[model samples]
Target: MIIRKAIKEDVPSIVSMIADDKLGALRENYQNPLPLRYYEAFKRINEDPNQELVVITNAKEDVIGTLQLSFIQYLTYQGGIRAQIEAVRVHKTYRSKGIGQKLFEWAINRAMERKAHGVQLTTDKKRPEALNFYEKLGFKASHEGMKLHL
Candidate 1:
């Protein structure tokens, strides 16, 4: 398997992975197949040197996993940057195979390379396994995250 930056063509695979049943209510919002704007946002991310999109591909070179890392520069941190991880998803067939860890490890290294104060992310309350995984990765629930349906 190869881990690399995501390209425009990978969007469909990314959308499929995230739309999997395992995603639960989170997918309820972005329920449709990926919209074109996603690639547009990806283009913006690609243009930003401080942001990154990572994907894991199988031997067949099919995009099967993806994650996002966005850098936040803060004044309180005093030159220490922050990285927020988002949209981590692996193909259904590839679940429980350490792909998630590999993706997160890549994000961590990228955050460190960017001199981030820390990396952060939020998973839904329904994703108990993911919460456990993040805890194992040394992340704590520092604040309560909420959302309002529009």
Candidate 2:
């Protein structure tokens, strides 16, 4: 599989992957005509120098996996820069083929190249399998994550 920066044309496939799971089905809009919000968000991400929207393609060049990485600069950790991985998803047909592992590896390497202090990601607490998958990749459950929906 080839990993590369996602182009605007890949947005629809990425959104479909995001809406493929049960949890995602509940939160993602998968209407017959997808919402414009997705395209708008893609525009913002594409314009951000610190953000990357990536896709994994097979030999046929079909996009089967995706994730977004954001490099953050903060005062803590001695003003270190860190890469945050988010929106990671692989097409259901492509799961269990080590694509996710390869994706994470790519992200980690990219982070190192950017001089990031570390790479971090959060999986839904309900996804025990995902939690285990992350642990195998050397991530630790070092802190509690909280959020407030607007």
* Ten contiguous residues minimizing lDDT sum, candidate 1: 23-32
What tens digits encode model 1's per-residue C-alpha lDDT throughout 1-150?
889988887877776777776554354335355677777877898899877888999999998899989998888777778999998988888899989899999899989988888999989887898899999988999999888969
Compute the lDDT of residue 36 as modeled in candidate 2.
Answer: 93
Give the Cα lDDT of each candidate: 0.84, 0.93
Candidate RMSDs in order: 2.5, 0.9
Q: Which ten residues in a row have the lowest lDDT in candidate 2?
A: 30-39
List candidate 2 stretches off by more than 4 Å: none
lDDT measured at residue 35 in model 1 versus the true structure, 0 to 100: 72
Clashing pairs in 2: none
CA lDDT, candidate 1, residue 139: 91
- For candidate 2, what is the TM-score? 0.96
